[model samples]
Target chain A: ELKVEQNPLFLSMQEGKNYTIYCNYSTTSDRLYWYRQDPGKSLESLFVLLSNGAVKQEGRLMASLDTKARLSTLHITAAVHDLSATYFCAVSPALYSGGGADGLTFGKGTHLIIQP
Target chain B: DAGVTQSPTHLIKTRGQQVTLRCSPISGHKSVSWYQQVLGQGPQFIFQYYEKEERGRGNFPDRFSARQFPNYSSELNVNALLLGDSALYLCAAGRPQETQYFGPGTRLLVL
Candidate 1:
């Protein structure tokens, strides 16, 4: 089974600070995704890292993938209050035929609280 | 185009009862996936359908079943619901090799 582990389950940082959320997977996968979820809302796609050394950035958030090491990282810069939300990293295992039928294994999510 | 949509934003049912959740994928989307998210936990995959056919299933019990329609809409039926079944049921829609977008989710509470 593929397992995904994320560090800093609960983070409390002040606005303008910088932090990084690390996601480590137990299996090799080329597809890694980052999502943000509010208290009761649906997940918002943040980044989709498809290949090794692939990195994507949106606003103050940046995500990178290292498929060879089975690891991915989501880095936050100049954190803001509106950026506070639970962030998750998900991985899709092998046998990916681009059918979009494969399910994703997700980490426990990092609950972020950005204090203004 | 509108994103994935789910019906009955919230539902409350007693144990042993059955409940059905509905999802309408984005226009022209042929793949739909279901997930369950418990409070304070990440979402878990439940099922995936493509072209109105079952493409994948998670480690759920037989009581959990789902099917897709010709219009690409999908329904998730859970039988003999348990308190553990109380969670946020989410639907995702996407195309081949595309990023799946999630719906608002149906919050099901089993008493």
Candidate 2:
């Protein structure tokens, strides 16, 4: 089974500060994804890292993947109050010749609070 | 496009009652997936359907089942539900090897 672990489950930071959330998986995967969930809302896709050393950035958030280490990271720069939400990292297992399942295994998520 | 859409934004049911949830995929999206998210936990995959066929299932019991229609819409049915089955049910749409966009989700409360 593939297990995903994320650090700093609860984060509190001041506006304009920077922080990084880490996600580590137990096995190899074909791709990594980051998602954001606001209170009482469904998840919103953030980034999809497809290869080792893959990096993507949107606004003040940036995500990177390291396949060899089975690790991925979501970094936040100049945090704002609007960024206060839960973030999740998910992984998709490699596919087989006959076409395997494409379900995603997700981490527990990091709850971030940016104090103004 | 309109991302993904789910019907019955919220539902209240008693134990042993059955419930059915609906989903409509995004325009041009061929795949639909279902997930369950409990309070304070990550979402768990339930099923995946492509081309109106069941492609994969998660570790959920037989009580949970789903099917897709020709128009890429889907329905998730739960039989003999328990209090523990109460959770937010989410639907996603996408293609294989691509990112899945999720719907707002249906909040099901089993009393």
Candidate 3:
């Protein structure tokens, strides 16, 4: 079974703190994606990692992918109260053929609560 | 450009009834996919349609079906819905099928 696991299912941090959320997957895949979900809101795309050692950042969040190890990380720098939300990591196969969907398999998600 | 859009932001249905949810993909997008998201969980792929043809399906049962129109819009139909069917139905669109852009989901509450 293809599975994605995220560390620290719950994270509580103070403003200006830095932390990293880890995502480990079973099996090999070429693509990984991260998303954020606010209360009652749809998923907001965060990062798309395409290759090993791929790194992307936006705002206070940064993400990295290590395909060799089947791991990905989402690092939050200088956290703020408004940055609190649940984050998820999804993985998909490298290619899709007819009836073979590279549909993203997602992690259970990590809830981050920031304290002011 | 407007992102993907879904109708009936919320719905309430009785058990054993049927429900259909609609979605319009982003302009110029050719692929539409559907997902079921239970509370506190990630969205699970349900179906994928490209060019008005079914491309992929998930582990869901036959009671769930979907189709894409020529215009790239799609509909997800659930028959004989059960109480466990209550979930947030999400629609996403993409050029091919790998990287998807999701729309605000429709929340379904089964009574």
Candidate 4:
């Protein structure tokens, strides 16, 4: 079975602090995605890391993937209250759309709270 | 374009009752997928429909089923529901195999 595990299920940090959320998977994968979910809202896609050493950044958020280690990380830099949300990492087993039952497996998510 | 859309932002059902939830994918997107999320866990895949046919199914029981329409809209039907089925049902849309765009899920409460 393909499983995804996330570290630091909950994090509370002061403004301007930095933290990293980790996602480890049980098997090899070719794609990884980062998403942000606000309270009672749908997930908003943040980054789609496609290859080993792939890195994507938007504003204060950056995500990286390491296929060899089967891990992905979402890093928050200079965090702010407005950036508070549950961050999730999803791993898609293959780049082709026909991976079938082995679709994206998502981490349990990191509930982040930034205090002023 | 409008992102994925789901109907009845909230619902309440009694145990053993049947319920049908709806979803409309993004424009021109040909694939639709369903997921159930409990309060504290990541979303679990339920079904994936592409080209109006069932493409993938998760480890869910037969009591759960779904279908896609010509317009790429979809419906999830749950029969003989148990209290365990109380969860947030999320609909996502994408191409054959692409990053899915999620909808504001329907929060279902089972009594």
- On DockQ, the candidate that comes out on top is 2
Q: Residue A69, candidate 3: how far off, in angstroms?
A: 0.3
Error (Å) of candidate 4 at residue A73 is: 0.7
Residue lDDT tens for model 1, A1-112: 7899999899999999999999999977778999999988999999988899999999999999998888899999999999999999998876554434568888999999
Predicted structure with the largest TM-score when compared to the true one: 2
Measured with C-alpha atoms, the lDDT of residue B7 in candidate 2 is 90
Give the alpha carbon lDDT tens digit for every residue of A76-103 in model 3. Answer: 9999899999999998766632225657
Candidate 2 Cα misplacement greater than 4 A, ranges: A97-99
lDDT of each: 0.92, 0.94, 0.90, 0.87
Ten residues in sequence with the least summed lDDT for candidate 3 chain B: B92-101
Docking class of 1: medium
Model 3 lDDT per residue over B1-111, tens place: 899999989999999999999999999998898999999888898898888988888889999999999899999999998999999999988876356889999999999
* Best of the two (1, 3) by TM-score: 1
Instruction: Give, for candidate 4 chain B, the lowest lDDT window spanning 10 residues.
Output: B92-101
Q: Score the docking of each candidate (DockQ).
A: 0.75, 0.85, 0.64, 0.60
Instruction: Identify the leading candidate in terms of lDDT.
Output: 2
**lDDT score for residue B20 of model 1:** 98
Provide the TM-score of chain B versus the true chain B for each model in turn.
0.98, 0.98, 0.97, 0.98
lDDT at A87 for candidate 3? 98
lDDT of 4 by residue, A44-104 (tens): 8898887899998999998999999999988889998999999988876664545664346
TM-score of each: 0.97, 0.98, 0.96, 0.96
Task: Name model 1 segments beyond 4 Å from true.
Answer: A96-100
Q: Sort every candidate by DockQ, greatest first.
A: 2, 1, 3, 4
